[model samples]
Target: MAFVALSEAEKVYIVHGVQEDLRMDGRGCEDYRCVEVETDVVSNTSGSARVKLGHTDILVGVKAEMGTPKLEKPNEGYLEFFVDCSANAAPEFEGRGGDDLGTEIANTLYRIFNNKSSIDLKSLCINPREHCWILYVDVLLLECGGNLFDAISIAVKAALFNTRIPRVRVLEDEEGLKDIELSDDPYDCIQLSVENVPCIVTLCKIGYRHVVDATLQEEACSLASLLVSVTSKGVVTCMRKAGKGSLDPESIFEMMEVRLVLGRCLDLAGSAGCLLPPWSHCGNSPH
Candidate 1:
């Protein structure tokens, strides 16, 4: 994470504005910046998408490859995430730098999609215990204004939606030999059902209030933030706490009570009471 150095006066100004529910960007506490998503941006890959939120830009690509299924989940396929922060995005990402930050974001993504309901893994399976499709998801950070986690999540969802794995059939001979054949039709492919794919929403604690989609300056003024992954159906699949400050019980509950309607979080609602669960906590900021 590239740190934005802000003076004490500037921090005070940003915090005061957040307390008044008016951010410097003219957004409310729960408001998010305009999101632009473009899918199938890469022709060589199976699926790809580009997302821009304010000044932050993210690109995600999904490549489907045949491989053996994991031992434990023999009947399902899995996704592998890799993040690359361009040196041009920020000075801190130069050379071998920002590797830690990329790994942190990748780990957070792995946690959010670890559940069985997040994706239909069974659909990716080509055989009961032998073969399956391994989706290699690669994320590239073109620019970093702030709110990297949220932007990456949105890009990933769009890329997965655009993904279409080629159809293959297995033929067995009487001598117990098996042969695999690929479909001749280019349109013959499997579309992944991303209905349950959750998006990460970040809430930064500023002064006494929390805000979503904080810019670099706004994030520098905050002490800590909470990351919550919620699906289209309002089901929470993952939660993570990050920052160097301590979060109280009340604030944690407030972050979990975010109401998501049609992909927009309007305000806090009581229906999320049953969705909160214990999650892993980290000391580094993933912004």
Candidate 2:
């Protein structure tokens, strides 16, 4: 995200407020903006979710396809993350304009999921190296408000939780020919275990203090921000520094502590309150 210009006086005011544990929006240092999450919002995908955090809007779709397993992990399936910054979000994203930003965000997601702790790829496999389910997690940015990473991660987690992959069995005869058979009941399916899926929390360093989930206006007043990905169990998976200005090592350590604390809150609230599985909701899309 590009930085916006803020007057010197405004910057000083924001910094002073942060030193007092307050912000322009009245949220404390660790408080997050209101989050709205809806599952199965799109019809074509096997699972989908839309999350709106303040002004940042993100949509995630999961499509399961059968494909050959990778050589390194022949017994496991994997996830492909694609981030599309749609023109609908902003006129700046028209045509291929958003390609650069999209690629950057997609790469971050790939790195975050590189560890086995993030997702159970082996469970997605149907038949060792012969057959496996590849989940294509496509994320669409509907708005470019500040804190895009955090919103996108939340949406992705919700969509995966909503995914229901149908049960398929392969039948082999004495001749060694294989036949794929779908489950007798269409409703019988498997759900991905997203208990370890991580959520990205962005902390913008404004003035002398930092804040989480900063809006675009607030982001404009800040110099740099830290991106931290944390799992539902409060485990930190990835961390990176974003934006223009540099951050001190001591401040970075302080921000990490705050990120972990806030991450736990978001995980508990989002999973229990907003991230409902499709079966639990009777397959009805949360419009």
Model 1 residue 228 CA deviation in Å: 0.3
> All candidates' TM-scores?
0.90, 0.90
RMSD of candidate 1 to true structure, Å: 7.3
lDDT of 2 by residue, 1-287 (tens): 53456788887787888889787777776677777788888899988989887778888999999999999999999999888888878777898989989998999999889999888998888888788999999999988777898888888888888898989988999999998887878589988878888889898898778888787778878779999999867789999988889999988988887776667655653454374344212322122
Q: Can you write out model 1's per-residue Cα lDDT over 177-249, one digit (the tens) per residue?
A: 8888989888999988777788888989998999888899998987799888888678888888888987899
Best by TM-score: 1
Runs of candidate 2 exceeding 4 Å displacement: 2-9, 273-287
Q: Top model by lDDT, which number?
A: 2
Total backbone clashes of model 1? 0
